[model samples]
Target: MIGLAATPEVSLADEPVRIRAWGLPPQTAITLRAWVRDEKGDIFHSRAFYQTDTEGKVDLEQSEATGGDFRGIYPMGLFWALKPTTPYRRLIKWDVMGSPFLVHLELYPSVLLVPSEDHLPAVTTVVERWYVAPGVQRLQVRDGRVRGALFLPPGEGPFPGVIEMFGGLGGLLEFRSSLLASRGFACLALAYSAYEDLPKFMPTVDLTYFEEAAQFLLRNPKVSGDGVGVVAVCKAAEIALCMASYLPQVQATVCINGTNAVNGNFLTYGNISIEGIPYQIERAQTTHSGAMQLSFTLQDPRKPEYQDCILPIERARGPVLFCVGDKDQNYDSLFFANEALARARKKGKQNVYLRRYPGAGHLLEPPGSPFCPVSQSPFFPLPLMWGGELVPHCTAQETCWREMRDFLHSNLAPGTKSKL
Candidate 1:
């Protein structure tokens, strides 16, 4: 007889689970597999080979994988190592509020690197990974040019407020906001473009629109503090910096793998317009896998000709946190981060902070999400390589997420303890 189990079968996506097997043959080889379907019905799976202990037990926390998707004793490796069955597809939780991801785990009697459909599992179990907690309420906002979803914690008279934005794939993403709300924030997942009646492309973004969104959060009755924090990644991170620089209501900002100088879009405010650093399509390198490595496709903002492209972040009224991945293949993230840091410091600004990850990618998502190094990009003709080693990228996500929460809490809701 063989048994498989996942303690606390249901858990938040960021939370860890304990997996173990009992009643297996001592010293026997086995294959453990995990599979889940994305919102598009695309299948993503990972498998690992392990040997049962002398006591005929295998604990993911202690057992090491001898072969398969990943090696070593990473308890949650199966969850993060998932790769899409369809080439170039990236796993995204499109309907985060609708349902949790149903992850199926199976145990096979023998080691099989690529298990066939005909092979039946000796034991199996299912686990649920949730983004929104039970009591969190999600509200769709379409208030006066501010189009997005607002998530509120249960029984919250007031909570730290956060405005979250994603990169070039401009659309409202609720997973991060929902998870933050569950952890005690009144979070707004803002959509700047490419959704509903918003602009179709990044080039048309107006700074006033983001100002309106920030004003909405500042005026919300459920939101605590006089100012709100901004959390953004990729291209949106540049916009967040703009908000922090010009908006007094923005108390803190987190910029993840973003460029210091504007790129791919012209930014406009009331009377000021800044030209973006143009993309040099000729510089894009095609990988052997046919994916495009776009790290060098943008004109160097540090050059004398592109001075206007640099954002005036030194004028920001709040503390800024810049997170960069040295292995980022989206652009030169480290260079951008360092440039921003140097400029802010040269201007005598003391609140700028930089956190560098050695082996992470362009898409630094919340923890427990699958590590996606290469994926199809809407902005390009071929799949894009985001560039990160698996274990290091996963590690960066987990560490950055916790620090982000603490930074927001400490700055936006001073004197309040972070939930982490």
Candidate 2:
């Protein structure tokens, strides 16, 4: 977690500050360690890392999230060390887009003492009672300990299910998956790291938990299980794609800003043969070249040498919707997604939808972010990748929302088990 900020923040979300405040006032403080991150940047310094708001007090550090999905119910904030007013840049790294990035922030007013359990969140719900949409919600099954919100859409007895995968630091804020749930779909914002009982560092893990979570969500009475879908961001995006090609229950996938490289356990893009995907699929594209140039050597996008894929993306059995930001210096996720789509098409599969944003960056298309929550925010710029471009409001963001809705409705359909 090196490569710290040379300066600090001293003002509102104007630009990077040349100097940092002298003392800790009545504000809250946070420590950040992700590069010019993903998922709703330009306003909310989101990364799903860790927070100390144990007392539930929104301190000065607790700024608001800007407009995107939910209009403004979920507020987000970021605290970065910077100079007083040096015309801030959201630079978090110098080289690659998907590097082992880090940009720390030790928020002020130090709220909670950060628990040690490392479990999911300290939250829980009966699930059945927490129906996402009116009668559309169902609880055919329930298992596992979790703390967070659930999103459900309106419908009848059966519906498709989708799981939201993100790294430990990328906790389950229930922003995206919940949105899908609202649309008559059963979506669980699954969290893995940054819980109370896990280590403070990252590690090479497996997809067992994700698999179990998917299985649970699918078996839920509300879910049709015909085609369980998943959407992951950043590192988890990699895992999501792997699951798409491997998980049997996974009907469709909308993998965002994830690496195509493979891991020890998860099946990667490069490793999978025609037997896995059986085809290639186009994700999305963008003018942002930083990410494409970032490199995929580490991302071994290959499936494990398993005899079968629980749910293969090639067999998408349903459909895929790829979304990426053009300004996503991390190699416009759209382009990367498109790369996968193309491969699928070449193999005679055509169930992928790739969408790319023009000026938007990573995680810019999240659902239901607390509106205008960028104040008192931390500017984490992709320093070296800035390329002299400013963060502009992109059209891709808006279209993506509509595209997602249409894609889901047309693909998942009503009373279907996520099957084709």
Candidate 3:
């Protein structure tokens, strides 16, 4: 019989799973395969080779990953890293936030011995989806100011609140906020532009709009914190930092792969005008592997424009977490993080923490998400390269997911911790 150690249902994407096979011929060689489906209904598969001991038993924990894109002993890692054989596309898509996916595993003979049964041994594992937390209220949030969904976790009076913003791609993505709400925090996926009812093109960012979102989160009856936190990625990361600096309601901020300066178009705050560091179109190069490279400031930090573009994040309040990838091809995440850290430190602030992942790419997605290498643009129409190879990319996703959850929970939710 083939079996799994943990429950057939798992909650976290990076949770460890143990698999075992026994009752077969001693010293037998076998192949184990898994199949799963994405929300798009795309079927994906992964297979590995293993050998049973004299006792006719094979424990995946003790086995080495041999024959698949991932060559590690962790079964969960194997499933997370599975890729197609032909063009090597991701075998699974873990981006269906709050939705569950089913997985099937089968054990087949490496070399058929005597054709005993008509079918191979099989087992099943279910990854359950997480919706809003019990008693949590899911509401449509549309005001003259903010446009997004608000998820309020089930609770009595007050709860920590967070305002989530997506990167330059611009549409309001509720996955992160929904997942966070399931973990016991009120989260709002705020959309500023590029979606229905929002601006079609990027505009000069105004902090007032984000400030309005923060105020909205704070006013929620379920929201308990003195000040709300902000979660943002890519270009939005800069916006988060700016909010933390300008808005007193922003008690904390998590900036991922963000720039140190006001990037893209110019940003305004009343009479104070902040200059943006424009992309060096000429310096942007594409690798032969089809990944577009960026002109990060690290390549030339001394450039006169770099100094002029830095944001005054030192004025921000509360703890800040800067998560960045060292191998990012999108921007100089490491350099920008360092600049932010230095600025915070220079201001005598000690709550800033910089978490750097080496060998990882620009795309630091939530846990269980299949590592994505290329992303399509909403306008210009070219696949932008998010850095890092398969192994490190997935690894970064797995770890960063937990880190983000804990950071927000610990800082925002403080006394009340989620069961996760």
Tens-digit lDDT track of model 1 for 1-420: 789999789999989888999898899999999999988889999999999999899999999988898889989899889999999888888787889999999999899866798999999999999999999999899999989999999985699899999988877788999999989999999998888998878665588888889889878898887888999998889889888887788889999998888787888888888888888989999999999998889788878989998988888878899988889998788898899999999999878999999899898998988999999978778999999999899989999999999899888765543222
The order of the candidates by TM-score, greatest first, is: 1, 3, 2
Pairwise lDDT winner, candidates 1 and 2: 1
Models sorted by lDDT, best on top: 1, 3, 2
Q: Tens digits of per-residue lDDT for model 2 on 189-278? A: 666656444333434444555677776676667667456677777567767776776666666777665544442233433344333222
- Candidate 1: list runs displaced more than 4 Å: 414-420
**TM-score of every model versus the real structure:** 0.97, 0.51, 0.85
Q: Which is superior by TM-score, 1 or 3?
A: 1
Q: Candidate 3's residue-wise lDDT over 89-141, tens digit each?
A: 43333343445556666677564333244756554444453433446577878
- Model 3 lDDT, full chain set: 0.71
Clashing residue pairs, candidate 3? 159-224
Candidate number that wins on lDDT, 2 or 3: 3
| Top model number, lDDT | 1
RMSD of 1: 1.9
